[model samples]
Target: MQRRTWVPIATGIVALVFFALPSEEPLRGFLPDWVSLVLIYWTFALPARMMVGMAWSVGLVVDIVSFGLPGAYALSKAVLVYLARVLALRVRTYPLWQQTIVVLGLLGIEALILTLIDFIVSGDLSGLQRWTAVVVGALVWPVVYWILRRARHLARLGH
Candidate 1:
């Protein structure tokens, strides 16, 4: 793979390791859905290369690490990446607020998918409690976008 492709893949591997580590609270409570944020940024910044399969693989890794229902996160992330790719042109032109709204909508769908999967596997609705994470994720989208934009700019400069 090219060096540019390796950057996100390496960061993704690190993120997977980070999420796999133990924590005081439940694994779900501590992790900030960093994988989703990274995928979103990469999808916008480099959609020509970051495919849905890549996002799905990262989601599967997350599912394994977090001990949640298998394929739950994978499906959600794949769908999110697909949507981001499809709407990238329109989304790229919008203001930050509009972009944030779009990200929030995507997060909401992801949360619902996870909830449904958890409910299907566990026969309970406890997954609904994790909605806070989605809200926090939505609120943090702008900051993540800014950081990723700057990082991409610097990486290009270094080239």
Candidate 2:
């Protein structure tokens, strides 16, 4: 059980590192939501082990690390994980490209959730430009999927 979880937790830490990295304003929107991508990957890869409470905990870490409103990201990430779990069996069999579309939709929903929270919490309405991260996340989903899959294989977690 411990070995089974090690790779996913390691990947989650890597995602959190990227999430916490500082970026200039112009490039901020372009940064892929690494945390969501990782969460989505593991949710698909290890559906039995990657549950909602774990996602909520990671989101709280993201919230603290990014200094965002508390629980904002927690709620969004929890929802993302739930949706991923619901679609996991179907999406897992999808070719990478088709899976990318699903990733885009999932991340888009997350973006909408965050947008709503931001507007309600700070009265800030985000522009469509914010959606760029969603697109980028989807575009890179195959890459993230490949890398994490490779890691899982190397870790002998089984397919």
Give Cα-based local distance difference scores for all models.
0.77, 0.89
Tens-digit lDDT track of model 2 for 1-159? 435557778988999898778999899878888999999988898788788998999999999998888899999999999999999999988988899999999999999999998899889896676699899889988889899988888777754
Shift in Å, residue 132, candidate 2? 0.7
Best by lDDT: 2
lDDT of 2: 0.89
Highest TM-score model number = 2
Which clashing pairs does model 2 show?
none
Candidate 1 segments exceeding 4 Å error: 1-3, 17-31, 157-159
For residue 30, give model 1's deviation from the true position in Å.
7.5
User: Per-residue CA lDDT of candidate 1, range 1-159, in tens?
Assistant: 224545666667766775566667554663457778778878877777778998898888888887877888899999999988987877888999898888878878888888778777877887544677777777888988887777676555232
TM-score of 1: 0.84
All candidates: TM-score: 0.84, 0.93
Q: Give the range where candidate 1 is weakest over 10 consecutive residues by summed lDDT.
A: 1-10
Rate residue 31 of model 2 by lDDT. 83
